[model samples]
Target chain A: MAGLTKQEGLSSPVSVSGLSYAYPAARGGNSRLALNHLSFDVSAGEMFGVLGPNGGGKSTLFKILATLLRPGSGRVRLFGQDTQAARGTRKRMGVVFQNPSLDLRLTCEENLLYQGRLYGLSGRDLARRVDDALGLYRLEDRRRDWAGSLSGGLRRRLELAKGLIHDPDLLLLDEPTVGLDPGARKELWDHLGRIRGSRKITILLTTHLMDEAERCDRLMLLHEGRLTAEGTPEVLKGEIGGDVITLETEQPDTLLAGVRERFQAEAARLGEHVRIERKQGHSFIPQLVEAFPGLIRSVHLSKPTLEDVFIHHTGRGFWNEGAQQESRGT
Target chain B: MRAIAALWSRELLRFFRDRARVVGALAPPVVFWFLIGSGLGNAFKMPGAAAGVDFLQYFFSGTLVLIVLFTSVFATISIIEDRREGFLQAVLVAPITRLSIVLGKVLGAATVGLIQGSFFLVLTPLSGIDLPLQGFLWAATAMALASLGLTGLGFCIAWKMDSTQGFHAVMNLFLIPMWMLSGALFPHSTAPGWLRFVMSANPVSYAVSALQHSFGMGSVALASLPLCLLVLTGFSVATLGACVWLARDQD
Candidate 1:
């Protein structure tokens, strides 16, 4: 139908500029600046990832794009229409929140059908679409089961299916893989990849996982409520100044001192391993071995991964530091 | 329209699946009608109508009003649960007007009120008192309008709210005063002059008066049918406006 046509790659998707937001002070404290002049564009049919640590403004940006939260200043346009001014922009978007949004009381099929009807599909149309969604998520077998009884991964899958039941032009998913096990996470990625391939839905999602960000067609990194960097995975890695080399050693400080004296290079020591970024690590290893014999136990040479690029840009490990802080604070 | 239907289905499905909640939703009005209806049954008599109108009939009308009020207020819990569970975000993200959501929920909660209201209708006949089909229909319509008004009110209050406890507290704070002044348990004539003036201004009093009119008591002094329906329409509109305001983009 005509609705199916809009489900194809958006001729023009969402674009924004200079979006800024501040949350009012909770109780008596100072107001928090949640987003600081954030600016980015999601092109048609691209799987765009927002990578950020907790409280890094990833969700705040997602909410702004979803029109759930209005930006205090700046403009957000969906399909070339100002989201705040246009009353109907919302109809073309679908979102899967960080938490499972399924109504636990209803069956999977019932939930989708209800969502479909909410979008104005009913009768035979609703039934067919709901069935398709259930099948798409491989949830047909459990159509009659209560949503609350489903496993975490299954519920997440159901959430995805429901978001797409309306065949929205844009899909905004926030931290969709946060709680899933590795197997389930992979399965969901497969589903997501298939969705982009087949339906051409413009997907904008947030995930702190570097591997997940690498899967996206393009990515934007948010830190302290600002966009730090954005580019394709390949482009981003290429943009990093040099290759990353890690050497495991019994005496990292001794090995690092020798390397620093020999090449005047910066060496970061972490526990028993030392990381050095250089133009050619494999060629330097031989000279290093000769300079400081037997100091190194194992050496690995690889091009910069997204994590390396993140470290090069941010000066700190992304997920590790955030994870440590989260654990410690709790 | 499709959005409204979806929300309505979700609400009914939620109501049916939560057996304890459904039972809880149904229990209050029944108990109130039985206990309070019995005590106040003989306390009311429509002027010029023979003192012959059964006390249960008079109080049953009030019970129906109470059912509308309680069903609408308790439906706020579903909204809070949906938000906490992340379902509200899913709906808001959908490409549908927010008004459809409020309408769907109001209609769905009204369905519950109708069911409970019908229970009262059924009980009257069991007690050997039969209202005409017209009377039953009129009462159902009145109760439904009241339910819609309250559902809209409940949606406005529950929208974007974080906690169920906080919502329940607000619901009680708003609902109790409205119920108390609604003349649901007592006739306005027995209230103090100032209280009567307050009851006249209270929307629920208009609603209860309309409901009592359905019992064939002919005491329409509180609110005429046109006035009651006009206020009902205004209540729905104002509540919907509030919902829209509450749902406005807040990045």
Candidate 2:
């Protein structure tokens, strides 16, 4: 519910206030609200992540920030200028969309050249910038190759290179690591971190993957078109204020009831396991085993993660809800 | 202006890089011209044909117009493809004006159509039409104007469409009929009163008439030479305006 501050001379790199959007009705269906009074601020030189599951309004927010969609209400400002009102704001910002935007028929260098020209860069300056980007992304060797011929990882790198060819102050990436494998994802994160370190540019990226969200300097959790939580990953995880304990048992329901009754702790049944959050969960694990000697089969004790923070705040598992909604074809 | 030039160059780069697209845009019209011209030449006769003039020779200017139509259509369809593939979104978010985007794309497509149409014009000798140097230059100018107008029209239609299937539907239902009634398929002199009226009303009729006059081919012109030129220029300006208007906002 806390909106970004509009204090004079205290402008953040990106700020949003009372942002909302709705998709118009399709056929017989009524209009659906995608974002509901969302607000947040991303500081300069910070890597901010908007974390959410599918249909959680991450893409809608991304579209609005990238200047592709007009918010139904409220305002978005980049560097103290209204995003919707100023064409100059777009010149200072770069956007990498969720979908591939590179023309596959053109070479890597050609794509960068065209992207540079869109931002009004041309001549030797444009050529030098294109070369710098190609080298920065380690795509110099593949500069002449068609974009379609590159692998997914290389194509993503090329996309990043093109996005930065104009030397933007703020770069918006919507799920930049969507289709990459684990190795490629890590490599991309490393490159992004390097870019932020060397260039001092602000980055805002959206991702549904909890691991990806953990890499961000600050994280905002969005669920069903509302801001659920916002903080550093560690701070958000610490919101639960205890360790998470999971116990595998023959009868999870009975074991959950027993734990709640005996330990006076809130325990929930999840599939074949009963999970509990409490202080000193490692010591409580042995006690739990002793209390349910024959019922418990296995136990797990670990620090809370971003996933746990999400569940603690929303009362549901992130992927499970998303998968169910997806299966229902919503 | 720089954005327009960049976008225009990008279109040409993509067009030339895809050899298949370049070949695809040029081949079908030539084959259509040959088959249809020869077939119709044997069966149909001109009502007031001069000695040594055949249907193949008479159909030559029409075939050039068909080439311009095909090339322009192929060039403009890339707009829909770019939108589907996300390239257009990237361009839309840039600092450039919407009019520049439309101008760049329309000019790019028009240039492609003009190039292909000129390539087809080289076959005038094959059709037994003797085009003098001055006439050839005029024919090229008329071809460029016609290409610009047709490509602008294609840009208008393609800007509103989301799918190539919808574009194909429009092409069949609207563009082909426009061409057929432009006296491209048959001379306006042989048509009935109502058909002649329709031909005179079609903008493309002036372009075809201008092209026919440039080639020194005897034909029934719906309007005088200066009048045809004026109409072609007006058509180009009007279609370009419509395209720019349609591209003003992202939906």
lDDT of 2 by residue, B1-251 (tens): 99999888887877887788888888987888889989988887777532345777767778888889888877999999999988998998898888999989989988988888888898888878889998798788888888899999999899878999999999999999998898777888889999999999998898888877877764555676678889999999999999888887545
Residue B187 deviation, candidate 2, in Å?
A: 1.3
Model 2 misplacement above 4 A: A1-10, A249-258, A290-297, A321-330, B48-53
TM-score of 2: 0.92
**Highest TM-score scorer:** 2
Candidate achieving the largest DockQ: 2
Residue A298 Cα positional deviation in candidate 1, in Å, after optimal superposition: 9.1
Error (Å) of candidate 1 at residue A254 is: 11
- Kindly report which residue pairs in candidate 2 clash with one another: none
For residues B1-251, write the lDDT of model 1, one tens digit per residue: 76787788667767776787667767887887777767666555644432565666666666777777777667766788887887887777666666676677778877776676666667767545567888777777777778877877887777767788888788678888888778676677767899999998888887778766666665633777668767877776777678767765442
- Show the colliding residue pairs in model 1: A69-B251, A70-B250, A70-B251, A91-B95, A117-B2, A117-B3, A118-B2, A118-B3, A120-B2, B41-B55
DockQ of every candidate: 0.56, 0.75
